[model samples]
Target: PPGISMAEEARYGFGQPATEADIKAWNIDITPTGEGLPPGRGTVRQGAAVYSNKCAACHGPTGTEGPKDRLVGGHGSLATEHPVKTIGSYWPYATTLYDYIFRAMPFTAPQSLTADEVYSLVAWLLHQNGIIPATMVVDAQTLPNVTMPNRDGFVADPRPDVESRE
Candidate 1:
């Protein structure tokens, strides 16, 4: 320890403990069962407007010509060699779509979309993907029940260490 003169431990103490309100505000996770989905509604018509304003620049007018990840079509193509993994073709749950948009989207600003805006985006995306009709209104309650095409495509892994609950 001749050359190692240890200085006193440095404690920056930069921040205070998060209060309950802070924790609650940040807990915005939405489950597949739609547990944490906020109260908001969006129709396909309204979603079209929202998409044109907020999303078209990146995702394209049709959600297909994306400079980013493609969001529409690609149905029944997952098993093909050139599988176009899109939201309709790959996503298993719609609630997670809401969760994702709420958490990160629009490319320019993450977590900047309001619940209503997120809902509208979800509605537009789903409509483009042919999952829901144009007349359909997507809300927290109906969103969880909108079954994705690939919902049953995923099978549970049978691990030796994990016993089957059934």
Candidate 2:
């Protein structure tokens, strides 16, 4: 303590350690198994309205004509010369989709949507992708069961020799 300069000590003391509540609030990650999913539910019909109001401007009215990343269609195009990687054709888990929409969607305002809104968006997107029926409701219990088209298409990375930076 005596050897360290005041400037160095001041630099280290700049920020306070995060509290448990702070960590909990920031820990909104959702796994592929729907673990850590929040409590809420949404229907395809409800999602359509949320998408129109919050998502259409950047992602297009249909999620395909997107000025941003396309969210639908592109099924079975992975092997083509021009593979159109969309949510329906590419994402492996519906729960992960919910995670993405919940964390970094609407482009302008990230992490602003309610859990119900996120669920609704996922339901509508899955319905648009033909992965789910229009009448299906999406929630923690049901969302994990909705399989993506490319679920079996992805292979585990064979490079165990490579170390993860994380």
Candidate 3:
């Protein structure tokens, strides 16, 4: 081990540069089909409590705001010259909603919510957006089944073309 540094040895000691275990630990993604979703459930009513306690101040009650970004409403604005891109009118993926909420929501306390809380928040937002019924409970099984109105509105990015060259 003469002339071999500890740092060099440590770098070269691994069999694979990165193992599946490492990748899996870091990649905590939930799919649109509810795959990888955690076990929990939240009703719209429960989400209302959660939202008021954790979310409303920043997102505004009922998701409408005088200053902050709106999380709901603005449905059927896709054809307008200036559309208000809210969850109801723009987002195409329900899993993205869950993922975003789980990872970065409640602005003041990011990532502070439980999986159930996240599900509840998603349910409440979707309901406010008019995408889901208010009485429904959002869980691993039900979250994915709530079809978004703009689900098919987005066309695949036909990129590498002239318009996208900028």
RMSD of each: 9.1, 6.9, 5.4
Clashing pairs in 3: none
Query: lDDT winner among the candidates?
Result: 2
- What candidate 1 gets wrong by more than 4 Å, as runs, is 1-18, 157-166
Q: Alpha carbon lDDT of residue 122, candidate 2?
A: 93
Model 1 lDDT, full chain set: 0.88
Models 1 onward score TM values of 0.82, 0.83, 0.80
Q: For candidate 3, write residues 1-166 as lDDT tens digits.
A: 6897888887756575688899866666788787878888887888899988888888888888825788887787779987889988899888888888877877767778898888888888888888889899888888888788888988778877666544
Q: Give the total clashing residue pairs for model 2.
A: 0
- Full candidate order by lDDT, most accurate first: 2, 1, 3
Span of 10 residues, lowest total lDDT, candidate 2: 7-16
| Alpha carbon deviation, residue 120, candidate 3 (Å) | 1.1
User: What clash pairs does model 2 have?
Assistant: none
Comparing 1 with 3 on lDDT, the higher-scoring candidate is 1
Best of the two (1, 2) by lDDT: 2
